[model samples]
Target chain A: MWQLFTQNWQDFLTGFWHTILSSIIALVFSFILGSGFAILETNPNKFWRGVAKVYVEIFRNIPLLVVTMFFYLVLPKVLPAMNGFTAGTIGLTLYTSAFIAETVRSGLQSVGTGQMEGCLANGLSYWQAMKNVILPQALKITIPPLGNQFINLIKNSSVLAFVAGMDLMYQGDVIASNTFQTIPTYIIVGIFYLILTLPLSYYMQYLEKKLA
Target chain B: MAIIDFKHVDKFYGGFHVLKDINFRVNGGEVVVIVGPSGSGKSTLIRTINGLERINDGSLIVDGKDMTDKSTNFNELRRDVGMVFQHFNLYANKTVLENIMLAPRIVLHRPEEENHKEAMRLLEEVNLVEKANSYPHQLSGGQQQRIAIARSLAMKPKVILFDEPTSALDPEMIQDVLDVMKLVAQEGITMVVVTHEMGFAREVGTRVVFLADGEILEDSDPKSFFDHPQTKRARQFLSKVISH
Candidate 1:
């Protein structure tokens, strides 16, 4: 295992780039979709809120692989030329967005009732209150849970390999197949994931402290 | 013309009948103190002025705007009618100073320099200038309540409402908050307060209104309210609270 990492150092370094790319893409898209869904879930109109609820349930209940496979295999048939990477990235975004919606919804709810009343009493409109006063406080309350979701999201990105996506895990499978060094190649992959997650975890901890 | 009026108001929380046929008038710069037992709708009555609580049936006119009208702009009414809650509902995310500055900046659209200066002055009035940068959690109940008062005053409203402002404070801290409010009353800003503090009522209030079981039991001057004892409920309540 030790020798494998030493020998495959260059390949391991290259894999880091692929892992980072998938994570960055997933993070940006998921946050956008997730925040949108969270707002929809909390909408005063029952119909819009119900629509958000259905979207969350549908995406969250299905396995990420199944969703990715459907996209990778089925979407191309429906609309020509959609590749594995596109399918996997889109799948990861949708799946992670469901969880992110849950996180943010709870965050918004955790803000006390008085905060809203206080804002209203001070003559701020509802949207103004939510955006300026409530969200800042809710975002603070949500950091630890949000950080956990982000780490889980990075690990979940490995599922991209099963769909023949050219992610870090796919590269690891190729290296192991060619070299017959399964344990070492996987061990290298595990270390690559550790390298990615540790710094992310630390950064989140730093934010928690700073916000505290 | 009366600055605030609640005429034949009846409020019901699902047949509970919270405030029955409430009639009161507060002229410009008159300080009215409402004293009552728990669940007597004193808070509800004041909240209706800013449309925080809808009266089931009544005409609530404040600064000439009829609150009963569905077309009335509640947010606009609230801009000119500020309320300090019993819980000292200062925005927890904001510092004491931000709590004071926010309304003036957003609602009034005042310049930043003027807002800051006014907030500083209000904080000084509340004796919270030293704690301006602190969060609400960092302050005691009395300090938080005082900050809440300053936040309401920042709007420069036509009238201010207090719903048991000092009810949640400690015994030692209650007098300080009342002192700030007494000063505010002295400044002749139209004020309506719901409180059990009969002493403060006697000292600062121009009129004293007693409520029981969601109905006005008595509405009179504080001197007559305490000395004369007009109603069975008001007399019993005053004796109970004052003896304690």
Candidate 2:
């Protein structure tokens, strides 16, 4: 195992880059989508809130692999032009967004009702209060949970491999199948995930401490 | 002329009537203290003036605007009728000075420097000038309540509401907050305070209102209300609290 790693270090490093890039893109896109849905859930209107609730439940309850597979295999048939990588990335974003929305919506709820009432009493419009006071505070409360969602998102990106999406796990699988170095290839892939997840954990811990 | 008029107002919380046939008038520069047993609707009545609690039936006129109407701009009314909560609600994330200056700078659109100066002056008035830079967590309950009063005063509001301001404070800290309130009453800002501090009520309140079971049992001058208690409910309540 040690000898194989020494020989294929370059290949593993290249695969590591692919994983990190995919995680970054998914993280950014998911956060944007998740925050939008969270705002929808916070809306006072019953119709919009129900719509947001339906979106969250549908995405979060279904298996991530199933969603990715549907996007990769079925989406191309429906759209006629969508490829595996695009479909997988899009699916990862939409799937992760559901959990992230739930996380952020709970965060927004945690910052006591008085904060909003105080802001409203101070003459801020509801949107202004949300933008300036409520969201800033909510962001602080949601960071740790959001960080957990992001790390899980990075690991979940491995589902792209089932669709031949060329993420780190996909490349590792191809390398192992060709070389028959199953354990070593997987060990390398696991290390790449650790490399991505560890830094992310530390970054979120830093944010939690800074905000505290 | 009365700046706030509650004409036969009725408020219900889903069939549990919290305020019934509440008729009252508060003229500009008058200080009214509302005293009652817990859940007697004194807080609800005061909250209705600023539209924090809506009246189910009848007219609530403040500053010549009908508050009972759905179109009435409660936020605008709140700007002129500032409120201090029992819990202080001092914007926990903000510093003492920020708590005071935020409303004037944001709501009134005052210049930053002018807002800061006025806030500092109010802090000095409350005897909390030294604690202006400290966060709410850093201050004692009395200090936080004083800052809350200063926050409301910074808007230069025509009227102010104190909802059980000292009820949440330590016994020793209550005096400090009451002193600031006494000064505010002297300054002639129309004040409606819900409190059990009978001494402060007698000292500062020109008029006193006694409420029981969501109705105004008595409303009269402090001397008459205290010395010649009219209702059996008022007599019972005063004996229960004031004797202690």
Candidate 3:
């Protein structure tokens, strides 16, 4: 098992790099999209609120694989086909954003209306009130949930492996098949994931305690 | 000239009428106290001045601008109108000084040094200079309300509205909040206060507007409205409120 890791180190490294890239890209875009939808969910306009509600329900309820498969298999019919990495990242981003939207929306709603009223009455515009006053307070309440969603996104990025996206799990599959070291290769993949998520999980726990 | 005018205004929440044909005007520099029983629309009436609540029918003018007009920028009007809620509603994430400085910095675009200087002055005005660096959660209810007052004053708003400002405070804390309010009244800023504090009303209020069941039962000087209320609703309200 040790020799297998040493020999297949380059493949593992490639997978790790791809996984990191996908997670980072998905994390950034999902946060922006989720936060945007969250704001729209809280918007006073009924139509926009409806749109947000539909988007959140659709993406959140759908299976992650189905969403990724749609992009990989279905999207090619209409638009130029994207590579597996692109399709996987987009699906993960959209799927994770639904949960993030729910998390952020709850946080936004939890902030007492008084805070927004106070900011508005103090001459701040709606956007200014949200940006400067409401979002900051909401963010404090959302940190723990958002942290969980981020970790989930990193784990879910493994969905990329199913589509030949060359993530850590994909490389593990390649090595296990070639070398027949299935158990050890899978163990190493699990360990690699722990390296990324464990510290984050601990950091979020610490934050929750501090805020509490 | 009237700074806030409500001309036959009507407001409803679904089928429930909240403010019925409200016809009243608040002139510049006058302190108007609006007192009523619960659901009497005291808060709603004052809120309409800043476009916080929309009037279903009729014209409303504030600070030489017609609020009911769709083209009117409510945010610009808000710069001239400030409000202190029953709850302090200070930004929990911001320090006390930041609470005061945020608007002038972001909204009014006041330079940092000038804004900081003004914030310290307002903190002095609220007698909370020492607590400038403290967060809202760190302050007592009275202190937080005082800082909220300082935050509104930072905008130099032409009119300030208080919606049952002390109703949410502890009995002991109420007096401190009222004292700061008195200081604000002394500055000759136009104020519309919805308070149950009769003593503050009798003392600082130039005019008293009595509301009951969404109607202006009486609008008179504080002395007559207190001593010789015009309508039976006003009389009954005063009796019920004063006895308790």
The candidate scoring highest on DockQ is 3
Candidate 2 chain B: worst-modelled 10 consecutive residues by lDDT: B99-108
State how far residue A1 of model 2 sits from its true place (Å).
5.6
Q: For residues A84-148, what per-residue lDDT tens digits would candidate 1 score against the true structure?
A: 77788889999999999989888888887888888999999887888889888877888888899
Q: Please list the residue runs of candidate 2 whose C-alpha ends up more than 4 Å from where it truly belongs after superposition.
A: A1-14, A39-44, A73-80, A203-212
Which candidate's TM-score is highest? 3
Interface DockQ of candidate 3 = 0.84
lDDT of 3 by residue, A1-212 (tens): 77878999999989998999999999999999999999999999899999999999999999999999999999999999999999999999999999999999999999999899988999899999999988888889999999999999999999998888999999999999999999999998988899889999999999999998
Superposed model 3: Cα runs more than 4 Å off: none
TM-scores, all models, native as reference: 0.91, 0.91, 0.97
Question: Residue by residue across B133-189, what tens digits does model 1's lDDT show?
Answer: 999999999999999989988888879999999888899999999999988888778
Q: After superposition, how far is residue A133 of candidate 2 from its true place, in Å?
A: 3.5
Give the CA lDDT, 0 to 100, for residue B85 in model 3: 89
- Which of 1 and 3 is ahead in DockQ? 3
Candidate ordering by DockQ (highest first) = 3, 1, 2
Interface C-alpha root-mean-square deviation, candidates in order: 0.8, 1.7, 0.7
Candidate 2 matches the true fold with a TM-score of 0.91
- Look at candidate 2 and tell me the lDDT of residue B119: 87
Docking verdict class for candidate 1: medium
Candidate 3, B63-170: lDDT as tens digits: 999887889998998998999988888988899999999999998999999999999999888899999999898888889999999999999988999989998888
